[model samples]
Target: MTTVNADAATPTELNVLVRPLPDYPDAERAYSRSSSLLWRRSAGAVEILHPWTERTISDSVMVASLSELVELGVLSGQEQFEDAAVQMICSSAASEESAWRAYYLNSINELDNGTSPFSPVHRRARSLIAGHEVLEVGCCFGFFALACARDGHSVRACDISPGAIDLLTTASASLRIDVDACVGNALALPYPDDHVDTVTLIHLLEHLDVQDTTVAVTEALRVARHRVVIAVPFEEEPTEHFGHLLRLTEDDLRLWADRVDHAGAEIFTDHGGWLILTPHR
Candidate 1:
């Protein structure tokens, strides 16, 4: 019978009695093997022969096995922790949020057949321009302009990008949506004073610099006889990213609206990233 000395064995010596299965390979096999060999070489160090073979366990062996199992579990948890940390760092570096937003916007435009994501903006613009002429600033590809024209409103759309203007013109011809689409700057709008019944500025305010934004707003006011519908991203805080030239908080919009109202424009506030200012006719 093999002499089982439970009291003489340390935790490390008892751990040697249980070997991991051979089916799953480990990258640290060399280190593990070397450590096992060093422990086995010691004199009076509870010899664990054929540790891979199943055998009945003494109380000491059972206690040692339990301790070893706990240590292994801790080490495995640590490895998982490290892996999760690495993944988080990689995600932060990749700017995943911005990528997802861009992907969502592109997908919506492609899947929705060139409709604006904000339906409220579309509806409000249509209502404000019902049986009236409208001008759209920064009308890239003329989606909103075409929508208004299709609804029987005379539409004039302008964009800074020549390519966008050309695309808008081609689309107009194909859709048979009569629209005056041109390439023009918002700061120097190519329209006479009090010409249009409504001016629509969708997602345009945040792109303009301070001077340009003021000038563009003034130009829109000058061109519109009735109302100017403007929409921008809801500003929670000032952000350098997202092409935000100047973050317009609700307070900022109110202040500007007051100025426009003083200039004979009656500003109407609407929730959901939109503001409609009707000029006193």
Candidate 2:
């Protein structure tokens, strides 16, 4: 597991401004180490490298397996509902007790689609999370939660859907990762004020009902002692292909950050946007 180096300071806010990279910062070096078997490169032209088989779960396999479960009617009527259907399929996948290939599909799809963790925004957000006690809301497969645990942060992941939490719980055990998972709602998180040092959400706000955005933000802010962090698609295209109710910009995120007078805000734009709310000392 990777932890924050002691020389790394605690971050009150993260403000990384980015644009799409033709390739990630160290692709060549990363691939060299991989092709040499420290990691393995995917066969595709994009050259997404895969780590040793036991090191991490690959994304494509996870996405395909998850899609199959959906087609098999695992999430049938719940289609239009919140991510409950998606959650159920993830849980089923994890419960299958198969190798990494069968279990981590949803994680792959979300990362590939840039809806959740593994985005450039998340890469930057790691600085803020390195040494904090974090509570993650709407933590789908708990990928960030897993990342936090790997980095030795104390993390608790909660979701409105028990199915998502269930999957996360299974993944944690099977993968031997440490994360506390449970059920909680975005609109009405079940935690007291300052329950943790920081509260974070990744790629979850856009799916929220427009009216509930304020409610969700308020609840998360209320529970965080230091700050709240969020990542959302920047000026996303108009599409219902996914349940995104509203695409967000820094200005929109500012509205949510402003609810608390003592909270100061910073915005980082990358593949999408990242919002950091730091408390005034």
Candidate 3:
């Protein structure tokens, strides 16, 4: 939910420029002056270099999750962060889109790899898909949609975030993968009733309130001919960085199924909690 707004004082056409860190005038002083400077330590810690907001983030779960991408050179360096922030401030529409596209293109290489954290989750989700026509709701960057397409499923995906949809669209075209991705709300899905065989709300419900979650599940069930698949992270407390608002347990998922008009509900745990809701004919 990061919104980038361009300052009226800055030039719309201005592109971010990178210079050697050592050559910059009094690097320490410059870091103090600029609020956007981020420094990466050799020990693998990230330090936000704002004068009043200097803090070193520990090697927590979030850092560990992204470490593989960094090691694989899929993630950007410190300089890129500075540049990207400048781009976001100066010319957000084009630059933000470009940033997302670049990240998607780079990260997809390791996304489905055996060692990747995402690999097992996606593999399990892919196996649970019941039919040929699939729709993945809240498919950020459409990685699963791409995987489904590779499996010969007529895959489509949508997300609430415009930047995410744009990234997915750009990556699908670049990889020559056919996935119809668009920007749409989960509560009010854009597809018609029984439009696809399976509708998946992968890691999406945690971001929604209880009311919206019910509406989203209802919408998915309505749109899916066979079943609706839901996956959520099992957390004691929701992680704010990931924009998670609710910590969903196995019982929570079962309760959700009870509230819906599903023929049956099968709940389990793999990397996270998995709930398969079979729609009534």
Residue 47: error of model 3 in Å? 7.8
For candidate 1, give the lDDT.
Answer: 0.55
lDDT of each: 0.55, 0.59, 0.66
lDDT of 1 by residue, 15-72 (tens): 2222233323442432232222111313532222212212222212222333233233
Q: Write the per-residue lDDT of candidate 3 for residues 173-226, one digit (tens) a residue.
A: 877889999999998999888899999999999989978889999999999999
TM-score of every model versus the real structure: 0.54, 0.63, 0.69
Which segments of candidate 1 are over 4 A away from where they belong?
Answer: 1-116, 237-242, 261-271
User: For each candidate, C-alpha RMSD in Å?
Assistant: 21.7, 15.4, 10.0
| lDDT value for model 2 | 0.59
Error of 1 at 197 (Å): 1.1
lDDT of 2 by residue, 11-111 (tens): 21221111112325665555323111111113211122222132233443334333332333222222322233233232332233553324354453455
> What residue pairs clash in candidate 3, if any at all?
none
Ranking of candidates on lDDT, top first:
3, 2, 1
Off by over 4 Å in 3: 1-102
